[model samples]
Target chain A: QQQVKQSPQSLIVQKGGISIINCAYENTAFDYFPWYQQFPGKGPALLIAIRPDVSEKKEGRFTISFNKSAKQFSLHIMDSQPGDSATYFCAGWADSWGKLQFGAGTQVVVTP
Target chain B: DVKVTQSSRYLVKRTGEKVFLECVQDMDHENMFWYRQDPGLGLRLIYFSYDVKMKEKGDIPEGYSVSREKKERFSLILESASTNQTSMYLCASSLWAGGGGYEQYFGPGTRLTVT
Candidate 1:
């Protein structure tokens, strides 16, 4: 069973536009949510993350909006650029669990 | 800075041959994980180790095993590699916390091919 589900497996947006990717989790035990950016031939790297306690967390052009009761979280890239074109994955982890559940991932492409 | 390093960036092995993938972390992390990445499948965990000499099966552990004799090194072994096992393998490390969550640091990944 897939514990975490992501929508829009692929996305295309214009430069300087907003890019959004959404994910939902079934495990209520999850407390921390993180997004990862992966480029070709490289492993996934940490992008942005949010906890259930916060409604939103932003790091520069990247933002994570979280909804605890809904079991949903979304990643938003403001002023998306060509460099932002990469696969995005959302993952969840709980304390002492030691295992992280990942979403299927979204391939985002930003056009010039 | 946290750095996780995989021994090889690419590897090829024949079917029924044993294959070993090595990973090392310089961050002194207590938790380490192995995962395989594939198209449409995202990343699936194969094994994870929380302490030296200890290991646990992740979501997909069939045909795979792990060794963690030391805190900084974790190894994934395929007793007999199969064609289906060909994929990109990633190693990650993180701090162990009983009640708090920590981010994972990932290596560059190894692309393995089984012929």
Candidate 2:
């Protein structure tokens, strides 16, 4: 029940297209959700995050659509570019939680 | 920025050898974590420390141990390195109450290869 399941192990998108990745969790207690981006050899970086309090949150070209009742969340990348090609991970945690549970990553490739 | 640094970027070892991966966070955060990343299995937490001299086991803690002597430093130890233990090890840190929310800052990761 602590696991966060992510789908589409790999994705291919064209430049200037929209890229979407989905993740769902079994634990409804999870309130904090965040997405991370990792380059070829670097560590994953915090890109965007959303809480159950809001339905959606957007930052620049990256947006996170969160559904509280369904216990699911998604990351949408607008204007996908080659540089955006990387591995993305979704994670979740409950309120006053100690550890964060991560999902199986999605390898996104944006072709020019 | 929360700076999390690992001791090595790449490490090669033989089976039965002991290995130690060190991690340090500059921000003096209360929580530190160690994880292993594989192809299909994203990141699995091995251990974490909430404060100096305090540690907790995570999902996959078998064949691994950790040490947190100081607040800013956390170490993952392999008692006897095995071929299957070869993986990309990551270290992260975050505060109890962080900006926006609890966000982890990861290190560049240490790629360990046990032959």
Across A7-110, the per-residue lDDT of candidate 2 in tens digits comes to 88999999999999999998777778989999999999999988889999999999999988888899999999999999999998776456788999999999
* Model 2 lDDT tens row, B1-115: 7799999999999999999999999998999999999998999999998889999999999999999999999999999999999999999998877433678999999999999
Give candidate 1's error at residue A40 in angstroms: 1.5
- Cα deviation at B52, candidate 1, in Å, is 0.6
Judged by DockQ cut-offs, the docking class of candidate 1 is medium
Instruction: Judge candidate 1 at residue A102 and give its lDDT.
Output: 94
Task: Return the lDDT, model 2, position B84.
Answer: 96
TM-scores, all candidates, are: 0.97, 0.96
Tell me the spans in candidate 2 whose CA falls farther than 4 Å from its real position.
Answer: B98-100
Candidate 2's docking class is: medium
Task: State which candidate has the highest TM-score.
Answer: 1
